[model samples]
Target: MNIVLIGYRGTGKSTVGKVLASRLGRTLVSTDAEIVRRAGQTIPEIVAKLGWDYFRDLESTVCQELAMRDGLIIDTGGGAILRSQNVDSLKKTGTLFWLTASIQSIASRIGGDTQRPSLTGTKSFLEEIQEVLTERTPKYQAAADHVVSTDGQSITQIVDTIQSCL
Candidate 1:
């Protein structure tokens, strides 16, 4: 019952992950939270000091560890699909579900978070998010064994959709 959630940020990976985990009686693990815990810093702090490459390496390590766990729901970082190896590893380990959402949904949930390193200083923030999301389209699709759109839906509905997928 290793249900891994992969998607762009603010797509409700963490929130939906918690719901999914509860519905399925599974443990929940968030890679970003794990990275923060291990590094004793917030994601923004880690990115600022250690850099993206370094953070990605850690993300991979965390993914590897989570891959070996059982009865778990993993909420991966948005860019976790950037590395093919990470995608392969996660797919091999569990059923990967991509929580698809519009750029508007993403911006609505995360627009105010200054700690969001990805779109913090971008000139056209929504466009920037859209661009990044477009860039990852094929990769996310390739990595996911299933897909669920979260826009205009309640969390419980999203969880129900995930249950159907499983």
Candidate 2:
């Protein structure tokens, strides 16, 4: 079975995923990183050059591909769960773990990241996060088989919680 990590950008999915995969002796598959590697661009670059639909299409394809693999720890992009198809595909052979954090925590963790473009084009980062997260919270909740809070938690603590859940 695969262990899939889902949440917003700053929730430690990638970091915790790396440690989880190492502890479980599984391969780590970061959908965003893979997309970047394959497309020869960062996420912001992809969104800027091709648009959000194009990026989502690419994300869907990646989700479909990764869903077929076993013994992997998949770290999904923050917006992966926005599409029901992506969520369904990832959950087919994977245990979905939604890593959650307060808006303040996320703001603090990824306040000035340039790699990811803003989903809401006209808003400030904090404003965008508040709005986007308000809409995405229910989707994330529905997608997750387990929900773990990452706020004020260390990488080791988060990994331990996920492992215990598994």
Candidate 3:
């Protein structure tokens, strides 16, 4: 079975997905990384040039493609759950694991990565994170078959929790 990992930014989706894939002997795929690669630009560059709507469309398309594959550990971007169709597709593909972390924790984890192209000039840093998390919570909850909190958890513990959930 496939394992689709979804969560807020900096929730360790990518890192945990990689670790889970290795432990489970499954291939790993990150929707955000794939979007960046296919767009032939970094995420910031894509958002700057093509716009978030454009990027999100690309993300949905990529999410669908990856969701169809089997025996893969897929890590999706935080906002991937915003669209119900995306959630429907993901649910049909495999088990969904929502990785979660506190807003402060997420901020510390991501830590000024310019490549992320998040709410840099739009709002206060803390407000931006909080806003995004608040908006996405229901969407994430709606999509999850399982939820795993990464806050105060070691990577091994996170991975172990995910395994147990599956």
RMSD of each: 1.4, 0.8, 1.1
Global lDDT scores for all candidate models? 0.88, 0.93, 0.88
lDDT of 2 by residue, 46-140 (tens): 99899999999999999999999998999999999999999999999999999999989999989878888879999988899999999999999
For all candidates, the clash counts are 0, 0, 0
User: Which segments of candidate 2 are over 4 A away from where they belong?
Assistant: none
Best by TM-score: 2
- Candidate 2 pairs with clashing backbones: none
User: For model 1, where is the 10-residue window of minimal lDDT?
Assistant: 114-123
lDDT at 86, model 3: 85
List pairs with backbone clashes in candidate 3: none
Off by over 4 Å in 1: 119-122
- On lDDT, the stronger of 2 and 3 is 2
Give the alpha carbon lDDT tens digit for every residue of 43-117 in model 3. 888888889889989999988888788888989988899888788887887899999999889889888777787
* Model 3 alpha-carbon drift over 4 Å, by segment: none
Clashes of 2: 0
